[model samples]
Target: MAGQRRILVIGATGTAGRQVVAQSLKAGAEVRAAARDPGTAGLPDGAEVVRVDLADPDGLRAPLDGVEAVFLLWPFATAEGMPAILDAVAARARRVVYLSSAAVRDHERRIERMIERSGLEWTFLRPHAFAANALRWAGRIRAEAVVREPYGAAAMPPLHERDLAAVAVRALTGDGHDGATYELTGPETLTQAEQATVIGEVIGRPVRWEEISPQAARRRMLDRGWPPEAVDGVLRAQAEMVTEPAAATPTVEEVTGAPARTFRAWVTDHADRFRAP
Candidate 1:
């Protein structure tokens, strides 16, 4: 195990975080998958699951000990407690790769600035829409093979989680990535309706895109316990995408030396989730 890189994955249970853990272990890194509840994290065998809660920055010290790089996925909507968290990370780790959004929302910008000032080598991954967002339709797809939402024409270059993790692992273990902000996206642009069709094709059924009014969609989301502001933000973004579609980026391939996976490939990988029980 000479020269084994030690990495700490802060959001080890999320979609992208899970992929980062797996891929880092595959690349021969000694990975510590940090979660609030390590016993329930269910990460792969090689990962040393450690208990660490970002909300309670004090808990990070033990997990960050002896770790050289950290892959951070800040789960908070605001930048509260970020300085303390970065302080703890910089105290132990020299490098941090943050999973940031391409939207560069206010909170994301604030956290990025804090990481820069923390004096640790840093990389920001600004990924476009995640292909896993399609999982939001899993229940309806399983029961009725239909997706009901507004702005069926909204177009995005959905990124595969594995691609995002690949870029992250490269930044975590390799050099020449410090101060880099990678704009990550999939290979092609697909409309919401087209994404539904791709899912249907992969699952061997015709899944229909039942377009609803933005108002109705907003109501439904609120009824499902979504914050009013979050619901509004989602609808507004989708509406904008209807007119101005998101563009695909070559950064994924440029960083990982592999072409970004298509939405079809993502669906094929998770087709069983959309199929009947």
Candidate 2:
């Protein structure tokens, strides 16, 4: 609705970051995609690609120049390097929208504070269980039509990355969202077992969620190359979620002018991933 300005996407190749880039372009913002390796980012044409490794804070300087807004996606597990990184971004960008977790773990909270004090116009998007997270089950389903994990009864409101990106784009381009902290979730709550059923329905098979011990789940995640602490956190969250299901919210529709997508839609969009190779 106003003059377009360059918006920098920090994790341009990621699930949500890719949508941010694409949606920003649709929203009429000039997009600058930043990644550790711009050569392999594979972002759509018309994006001005640049290299900025968050591990090296000073490296962000060049890529962030002339950026009017930033979609801050933290790909790291810790905030040890974020102070310097935020400094580099704040020096150039007038606006920033952070892709934060609803879990609000310690490191993320610390980074949130820094952004609040950074003097840039900011908004925080805290999204719950990502629907695309079911991609983890894609491999297992493709091979055996079964998903083995703890907390099969644990419920989640899995928000689509596209919905998250739509809200982020609105915050980046439009007005009145400044100082807002949006809690985003999908349109409905579905348990882990139900999610498996939905996947099965989408793929024309009987997908089953087999309950396993927490220790076995932890071991499996560790074997999948997940860091130890993050694995523990995932199991811990799922364990806690058994009694308290994740709640859906209307924030996505309020901001994006469209309701948050359901897990069925996400599974439909990514059904090919579950197809046997």
Per-candidate Cα RMSD to the true structure, in Å, reads: 1.3, 1.2
lDDT of 1 at 22: 97
Off by over 4 Å in 2: 1-3
Candidate 2 C-alpha lDDT tens digits along 256-277:
7887888999999999998777
**In candidate 1, how many clashes are counted?**
0
The lDDT, on a scale of 0 to 1, for candidate 1 is 0.94
Candidate 1: clashing pairs of residues:
none
- For each candidate in turn, the TM-score is 0.98, 0.97
**lDDT at 188 for candidate 1?**
99
Whole-model lDDT values for every prediction: 0.94, 0.90
Model 2 lDDT-worst window of ten: 1-10
Q: Write the per-residue lDDT of candidate 1 for residues 164-258, one digit (tens) a residue.
A: 99999999988889999999999999999999999999989999999999999998999999999889989999999999999998999999889
